[model samples]
Target: MTSSPLSPTETLASARRTLRTEISALQALDDRLDASFHSAVQKILSCQGKVVVTGIGKSGHIGRKIAATLASTGTPAFFMHGVEAIHGDLGMLTAQDVVMAISYSGAAQELMTVLSVCKRMAIPIIAITGHPGSELAANADIHLNVHVDHEACPLNLAPTASTTATMALGDAIAVACLEARGFQAEDFALSHPGGALGRRLLTHVRDVMRSGEALPVVRESTPIPQALQEMSRKGMGMTIVINETRAPVGIFTDGDLRRLISREGDIRQLTVADGMSHNPKHVSANALAVEAATLMDTNHLTQVVVVDDHGLLIGALHMHDLMAAKVI
Candidate 1:
């Protein structure tokens, strides 16, 4: 029987099958992690200089990410082009540095050019490739085998699964090394200071919450109109209603004003406490913005009153402020 030309449905099915096969291949590869993997971790952990990652083509792209991940995770590393190394960039290599060469076939000519230079410098070469017995692997101090049995691409010729496996292996290496060195979240956040998670972990409420005279505050006995004036003057969505002790008792918002007017209530006759939402959500000055965000979300609030340990109104934080600060 002859094979028939695939219909559209069959073509899609074939593509899905390839991806499934490649995904399974990675799972199979995961089981192979053992003492050798641990040994590689030890080598990187003890390195005195930066781990220089290099490759050509698709492998080069993966190498760049590996270098960045390693660098950001406490391992000093950077990427150098294999071709550039021979064209005077070889001086970037030091005896103290470790060379990481990446290739799918372990036969990229540009990588081979730099591998010999690494050898001359007495630098330890770590290779990540699909071919363990290939020259690039055999020439290295340690070869991280990233072999994939199939490609996620329908043609079975693209770098899809191979790159995925390489990336996973790079992450595995970085994590193992990080754990061995007892790396902490604070350490990781320091390198990712521009991201939301970093801001949440580092930014204190005191750093961004409105304070000083700008804080929205009004006495409980103050008339609803006066409290509305305070809220408007402060530009905060709500004003903190407080007693003589200067401790917060309630809060009044634009939302509350709408509801009070809808009831045909007299704003001038009402007290600040009458229009306030008692038991309004509050945060401490030292609280993390991320915690504040969670509290605001859970309480269905757009703003939170910031108070000191004594429950005295200190400042206020709005949802927009959190968004601008990238805390959201």
Candidate 2:
């Protein structure tokens, strides 16, 4: 007797087999990484001018993304489409620059044409491809191989595995270069100051803090009623209860006043020190506003006093100040 086509279990087994093959293919490509990767990293770091990543089709799209990541991380970079290089755009290529050329097979006609022009210009070239023997790899100043044994697609035609390897390899090169140059978060922030992460990283407490007469401060012996008036006039929702030196002795807020009400204590007899919280949380003028935000968030507070190392109060900041500065 002949057996019928198997059940759902058999179909699932086929799918698992495909997934395992693709995952292994990606892992195999990763394990194959070697010295050529370091060579590529050196070429990028030694580059005096911008990194220009060029490729045709899908590789071109990935090239643009790689360039963006490099630029944002402190290595200057831009993308030149491979096909456009053969047109009038080859003029953008300069001898001072290093070129990163991407091709899966390493034989794309447009890439070959651009590589030839790069040779004539004496610009050093780095090649990324699956085939080591391809013409594109032969002319490289440094060569990086992104070989993978199989495609994730069942038909073995789509670019999933190859592109993944290429992208992974590009990221490896970028990070290696970033580490060599000691690229820092502040450096990244300068490249992206208009973005939220940039603002969060670059903005300092001095840039967003309220200083001078805007500071809500009262001496330690001041009457509670007058200190309440000072808090009201400052509009920061709190007062820096201070000493004779204008250093913060404590703090009083609407929170303190709310706790004041319904108590049998006499409002007229209460000294500012009686209602003040001693040694209130404060930040320095040079500190990051984001740090101030963290201080407020961690302490369940709405404001913080800004002081110098000597304990003299120099500034005050409220949570809304952070919101307005986009520090939150």
lDDT against the true structure, each candidate? 0.87, 0.86
lDDT of 1 by residue, 61-118 (tens): 9999999999999999999988787788888888999888999899988888898888
Question: What are the TM-scores, per candidate, against the unseen true structure?
Answer: 0.79, 0.85
TM-score of model number 2: 0.85
TM-score, predicted candidate 1 vs. hidden true structure: 0.79
Evaluated against the true structure, the overall lDDT of model 1 is 0.87
Q: Output candidate 1 Cα RMSD.
A: 4.2
Give stretches of model 2 more than 4 Å off.
1-21, 259-264, 297-300, 323-326
Give per-model CA RMSD. 4.2, 4.4
- Residue 143 of model 2 has an lDDT of 82
